[model samples]
Target: MYTTVELVRGSSKLADEKAMSAADVEMYIKKAQARIDARLKKRYRVPLAEPVPDIIESIATDFAAGFAIEKYYSQRPGKEEPYLAEVLIKRAEADLAEVLEEHLLDGLPGVEFLPPPGPAPAVLARPAMQSTTPVRSEMTAALERW
Candidate 1:
């Protein structure tokens, strides 16, 4: 996983472990990593191998934390300020979109970009026939008979 449960806890507003269970946090992190992989697979080989890029880790943390807070938090009735969760998710998504559209992973180590899969070349599927029998015209047939 790009981000860990600890990182998600640190990045989010969950002050006490009581607020959100460790298993829930871990689940969020895994989901966040999967989401990242889905988004990045079009450009790079994903689940991203080991020693993942720092930016990717950060984005995953943000996503996981946001998801946890947005889903599990119980006090959304009268809060006036925007939830940190929303901000984190929006920023992470924007960054991820930029990474996808702008070729941001071009020079990073361990990052493999996939060439766009396109249509197959227009070519005959079968081999050319060799030693074909010559077409015999009516005149040629008559001559042959003669």
Candidate 2:
């Protein structure tokens, strides 16, 4: 899994909320991991191996915490304006999308390897041009005539 239940609890108010059980939190965490994996599988190996990237863990924790909070809301609805859980989920999703879309995981473990950036292309100087005619002398003669 990208993140642990403890991590999910720590990142959000899951530990403070009494509505969700440890098992329920774990379930939500697992689902969040699966969702993260499904989206990242295109560029990284699902269930990412040990030493998972910090960003991945962060993303997973946000997703899990958001899910658990949503579950809590379902069980005990509240009038709290601006649901924080939805914000968490949206932020996590956007972060993950950016990682994939920008190829940000190129060198990270469990991700498809990418070649290092090459040096900047060489700049070629244009050849200097020279006039075949003796324009200086011609101009001098013209000025004299004028």
Candidate 3:
């Protein structure tokens, strides 16, 4: 049995590391939901009061985590950095999905599953030379005119 701390810690680590892909993130979400469902199924054994909040909360947490990871990686030096950031984002996404699944499995009404968000685009992919080229050319032209 996976402890909540294990799940949260793993998820956070993955997000911070950005080591996951878009598809992997989606799969993580699904797996989390399944885990939550199985747990609730065993625990409640009856319908829930309302599942929508749980679902929404779960999704929100994942999105928030994704955003945070993306923001962090945006400031990093290169695209070649290990994909730890991606992993962290996926973990967040999974957490959200799991919460939703738990509520739904509890028999709460009006619960809906949300799709996992896409991975953050590669910011470090920008050519390092692109920005420098224009400035270099401008300086050269200026020097020629001088």
Q: Is candidate 1 or candidate 2 better by TM-score?
A: 1
Candidate 2: residue 102 Cα off by (Å): 1.3
Sort order, TM-score high to low: 1, 2, 3
Best by TM-score: 1
User: Over the stretch 48-146, how does candidate 3's per-residue lDDT look in tens digits?
Assistant: 234434553454334434443454457777763236546645664566456545544443454333345667667865656545453567777789998
lDDT of 2 at 12: 63
lDDT tens digits by residue: candidate 1, 7-71? 88888877588989999998999888888889988778776767788888889999999888887
TM-score of 1: 0.73
The per-model lDDT (C-alpha) reads 0.82, 0.77, 0.46
Off by over 4 Å in 2: 16-18, 112-146
Q: Which is the winner by lDDT between candidate 1 and candidate 3?
A: 1
Q: Give the lDDT of residue 72 in candidate 1.
A: 69
Comparing 1 and 3 on TM-score, the stronger one: 1
Quote model 2's TM-score.
0.68
Cand. 3 Cα-lDDT = 0.46
